[model samples]
Target: MEKREVVVSITDNGPGISEDIQSRIFDPFFTTKPIGKGTGLGMSISYQIVTEVHNGSIQCISQPNQGTTFNIKLPQKYNRVIPQ
Candidate 1:
């Protein structure tokens, strides 16, 4: 989203996820991190809030050894905090 659209993003420089595992990235409690580093629910919950709760969209893009980016799209008028 841009200009008149709502946009949200998350980026990372870690070892990019494999294509086989990409589909499960948003599943609850799914994580590539170590035990203490994460609980793995953050993404699943975030996705739920953006789509089901706020009627927005979320997506992730990644490349091995490069980086990853998460993009979220929504209607500008639906940005409750921005007051368009």
Candidate 2:
């Protein structure tokens, strides 16, 4: 079967994430926010939903003071039976 891919990106103008913490952004329970401000599960859950549930991928690109961007890629075609 032929497969198609889709790419989606989100960009922001706020202060960018540091390189040191970029790798851990998708880790469960990881957060850079102050206590009570965040639970840090957002990215982690997003990662799982894309990569695990949809067989897709996610990435982040950023530089200090240059803002951040999130890139998500998903297959437009999947080898699974659809419910009718």
Top-lDDT structure, candidate number: 2
Output the worst ten-in-a-row residue range by lDDT, candidate 1. Answer: 75-84
Error of 1 at 47 (Å): 0.4
Clashes of each: 0, 0
lDDT of 2 by residue, 1-84 (tens): 566788999999999999988989999999999999999999999999999999999999999999999999999874666999
Candidate 2: what lDDT?
A: 0.94
39-74, model 1: which lDDT tens digit per residue? 999989988998898788898888789788889997
Provide the clash count, candidate 2.
0
> Residue 44's C-alpha lDDT in candidate 2?
99
